[model samples]
Each structure stands twice: as structure tokens, then as C-alpha cells.
Target: MSSPKVQLRLNGIRKSFPGKEAATQVLDGLTFDIHERDFVSIIGPSGCGKTTVFNIIAGLVDPDDGVMLYRGQEVESLRGRVGYMMQKDLLFPWRTVLDNVLLGLETKGIDPKRALDTAREYLSTFGLSGFENSYPKMLSGGMRQRVALIRTLVLDPDILLLDEPFSALDYQTRLYLEGILMEAVETFHKTVILVTHDIDEAVALSKRVVVLSQRPARVKAVHDIALNEHSPIAARSDPRFSGYFHTLCAELDIQTRKSA
Candidate 1:
């Protein structure tokens, strides 16, 4: 037997919803492969089905066409294998930070005592040690997002699906969270797929950036981002960063117009 492998594969995945008079196609023949430990970003214009791509991957919605394979096998359900962090933190107001983070484990029927210990371990690792008992309302926006991330991480999912996880924060907070996310993904060696409209964020964090076209989206381009510093925080100021940013932005603009 070989070592356990983890990866997500998509082949000709498609989705459609009822439109005003007909089925409104969202994703059309979208195909991609996310490697076992790759940090990937998906960038596209508004209404380009970027989130739909993620929704299908998460099994929150079924694809009307094609296959989604996990580790070379078809993914029949997404109950425990995928950890999703949405735009909103979505923490329950009543639960303390630690309890919120342990929700996944509790759902899995992990003993509350053991799960609490595990959640604490993640909090400490992610720079969230002391806030375990604090309510979600007590933390800053950045801190709350950090707890949200810990909530996902504590579940030990092989892949993380981030849907514009930083779009709601201020510029400074977003930058800080980028650093934190980069560190977490690197340290844990987790496969991540981040969906965002921010070209700079895509270029800043992804090993490869996937760009999609407008509504009824399809893959327009795939770019391998080369940076001297692999860390998102340090890579921002590297002399070569802006060149990649401009190239991606230009491609996005061209695609947006072509689809328009």
C-alpha cells in the first residue's frame, strides 16, 4: 500500500439555477485539480461563479455535470472531510471562543474534555491562547476571524475552503490576517483554496492562481505566482510582486470585458 494521499479533483463540473425564464448557467465545464498540499487561489469578477465553484467542492450544492474526486476517489459526501471558512465569522454569540472552536469535534462525537484540550492547543498555536473564554462579541474583527479559523482548524480537515475570508475586515486587519493565514497553512501543510475578487490577495498568497470568466464561468487562465518570499506578509514588498499583480489584473480586465 502507498502512503495516504489527499487531493481534490474536478472534471467538467457545472451548475445551473432557475433564472427569470430559463436555467441560468453558473459554472460551465469548470475543471481543475488542487494538489495535496498546494495553496491555491481562485479569482474572478463578480457573478463569475467563483463561490459556486467552492460550493460544489464543499458539497453544499450538487454539480449538474462532471465529477469531483477526493484523493482519486469520488467524494460522496462532505460532512467531515472539508473545513469551510466563510466570509462572515458566523460564531454563535452565546458560546465562548473555545466552545465555538470545539463545535466540530463535538459534532463528530469527540469527547468534550478531549476536544476542549485540542481546541486549546490550536488556539495557542494560532496566537489565540488567552481568549478562550471570551465571547465572540468581545473580540476585535481580526480576533474574531482568528477564532473562526481556529474553529475550522481544530476539526483537522485536510483541505480548507476560504471564501473571501478577509473581505469584511479593514485594510490593516486584512493584512495582519493574511500573515496569520500564511503561517497557519505553512505550519500545518494544509491544502487551501481561497476565493476572492482581490487580485493582489490572490497573487500574495497562492502558489497558483486560477482565474475564471464571467457568468457561466470557465477557467480563463492559470498562473503560477513566483515570489522570492513564500510568506504572504514578506512577499508583498518583494521587488517582483507588482509585475505578477499587473499581469493578473490585466488578464482579469480582458476576461471581464470579453464576457461582458
Candidate 2:
């Protein structure tokens, strides 16, 4: 009955990087809003500055122009309030699964006993219970990714910035992980902004999908995915899924052809 509250807002965000000839504009007047508990996926042609958007949101890089607001208050960057997970799991090989998950909390100086308990509870819930002592080298790709997700989630950030986190996994593993990610979002009440190249993945996981134009990227379109199911697999089975997927494909195709 009530409107969803805006958790994050990007207003006319612009960014450029120095190139040999001149500055290369990556994002130009990109703007969007993420609501609380919203799973929003961003898709665009390759090199469309999707990752640049994420970096700005994560405080890893600053934008050349525009403003970011959190909960109606203007802010420069969401460094402490956001959790970022990239395409690579980025797990330390020598550390055990539990240790890797505990890394963030340790860095924040959280009490060791409390942090261990929290990490173990998440591992158990995510079905990584028995692999606590297993090293990253000992785990499968999916398991390592699970550990990576746990590592990000344990920090308890208000928003999650996922930069194609499941892009490298097999289809089956990606589906399973999508389910886990959906569950985590619901359980933790997180707001998520995902940058992905996969249209199907975006349709299955996002409440809304934001499409961007090619380099010096700007918001091209935003589609609300109206699926009756939440789980990725079940979302695919929805009769509306094909329509959304094809529509998104067409948008990207048009962008690609124009760029070419």
C-alpha cells in the first residue's frame, strides 16, 4: 500500500579516464534510483562503463560530475554502507573458508568470538557447513564463490554491489547460486545493484533491469520484471520470462549495431 523507499540515488553521474589521445568519457549523465530491498540489474554492451558505475558506488573511484544520495541525504560515496562482490571470488588461497569469511569482520575489529559465530551461522545457512576448514584451493568454484558471498554478507552493509559475480560459473552452478543470492537478499533485507552482461540472469534475478548505451554510457531503458516467482529457476518458467528476455536482447542488439 506504501511506496518503496529510495535507498540510493545517482543523479547525472559522469566519469572519464585519461587516454593517450584525450580523456575517454565512460559514463555520461547516468542516473537511476535503487529502492530498499530492491534487486536491480544493470546490463549494457561491453565497455559501457557498468563497472565504472559500480566503482563509483563502492567508493573505489570518484565520478567526474553528479551527486549520489543515500536515503534522501547527499553523500560522496557509500564506502562503509555497501558490500561489493566482483566477478572473481578473490579468495585468498592460503586462508580456510572460515578465515576468508571472517576477514572483513576482523578488519573492522569486531570481537573474534562474535565474528566467528556470525560467520559459522552464515556458512551453515548457505550449506557450506562442512567446508569451514577447507582452503580455497580445496573447494570447487561454486563453493569458493559461496565463501566469497559469505565474506561480503558478513559485513552487514545496507547495499550490495555485485559486478557480474556469477559470470564465470557454469549454468547449473549459476542457477543454484542465484537461488542462494535471492535467499540471502530476502533474509538480510538487502538492496542490490548488479552489473551483468547476461540478459537472462538479469531478468531472473532483478526486480528491475536498467539498460545503458555504449561508451559514455547513459540510461537507455528500465524494465520492471513482473514475474510471479522469486527463485531464478522458477522465474525462468514464468510465461512472462521469455517476453522480458527477448525485449532486453533487442535493446542490447540495437545498441551494439549502432556502436558498430
Candidate 3:
């Protein structure tokens, strides 16, 4: 049998930003890869440059040194190949829900009527059919995030970079969306790289977890998640789940903190 194809690769990525005194290095020669149709979660300490990695992959920020390859060729930018979603919904207040979701296809020179039709179909699928005419402010936090996701998914990019996209939502909503996200990935065959702080969320949504170190973040470990139950909520009951969670917390220094 043949091995899975590599969808993306980050080689020797180095990045830094101006600090109060001098440049503060965020990523120091970090390297990683994402296989096709994978759901990979990235976990690390705060300020460890996890978002920086997402930015580089999404073409929002350039690294000082590194090579990013989509497929076999070096990618100049991920403008069309990647879709990015952040913690904040960042939806337009003026645009209606359907109009907002159509933003991606519209930018790609797709026909206006066609984009609207496609966006409508997605809205219907995601249970926002009746809310298409509603504005961003009218929707709940969870609803807004769903719209944001639909906007990204409408473009049907090869990969998706989700940066704590569910962090701001309530626990129940977060869990609900995690299941939906998994279903979306499965149905769309999307290769996703998610940056998140929640260990359980990572374990629930990702097939593999990439753990990064402190400042100048580098890969510390990668764990393949093998859950006894398939669903995110059901996976919690799996005896092995807590072990994976504990191992991750240990790596991220979560378990070592002394009591105040």
C-alpha cells in the first residue's frame, strides 16, 4: 500500500518581531509537515509563536527564513490554497449572513449568482437557512463563528488554518462546533492545521497532535490520537483519553506549575 501524500511542509522556518529593546525571536528553525486530508492540532505555551506559524501558512505573515511547500513545489503564497479562521468571527456588520459567506467566492471571480447559490446551500446545510438575511450583530457568538467558518469553507481551499476558532464560545457551543468541524473536514476532505489552547479540544478534533516548546518554538513531540469512541464527546469516556491529555499538559508545563 502507498503512504499518504504530503499536503504541506514547513522547513527551517525562522521568524522574529521587534521587541522593546531588540528583535524577539518567535520561531527558531521550526519545521513540520501536514499530510493530505489530515486534522493536525498544534499545542504550545502562550506566546510560543503558534499563531505565527498559522500566519505564515495563511500568507498573512512572512517568515524571515524558511521554505513552505504545498505539494512538491515551493509556494510563494497561500492566498488561494489556504483558508484562515481566527478566534474572533470578524464578520462584517453591514453584510448579511449570506453575503458575508459569499465573500470568498466573490473574490475569486466566481459569478455573483453562482456564489450566492453556493453560499445559500452551505447556510442551509449548517442550519442557518432562515438567518441568511440577518446581520452579524444579530447572531449569537456560536452562530457568528459558524458563519465565519462557512465563509472560509465556501472557497474550498486545499488547507484550513484555524487559530483558536472556538475559544471564545461557551463550553457546550464549543463542543457542538467541534463535532461539526470534524464532520466538515471529513465531508470536504480538508487538510487542517489548528492552533488551540484546550487539550481536550485538540484530542477530540485532531488525528495527530503536534506539541511545541516554549519561546523559539520547535516540535517537542507528536502523538497519534487513538480513541475508542469516534465522537468527540464519546471519546472522553475512552480510558486512553486522559492519558493523552496528561502527556500533553506535561509537555506544555501545565502539570508542573506549583500551587500558589
lDDT of each: 0.86, 0.92, 0.89
Q: Give me candidate 3's TM-score against the actual structure.
A: 0.95
Candidate 1 lDDT over 1-260, as tens digits, reads: 57434488888988899888999999999988788798889998898898887788777888899888888888754647778998999998999998899889999999888997899899998888888899999999999999999898888888899999999999999998998888888788889999998888888898889989888999999898878676767788888788888888887774433443
TM-score of 1: 0.92
Sorted by lDDT, highest first, which candidate order results? 2, 3, 1
Alpha carbon lDDT of residue 254, candidate 3? 82
Q: List the residue pairs that clash in candidate 1.
A: none
Instruction: Report RMSD for candidate 1.
Output: 3.7
Q: Pick the candidate with the highest lDDT.
A: 2
lDDT of 1: 0.86
Off by over 4 Å in 3: 228-230, 256-260
- Number of clashes in model 1? 0
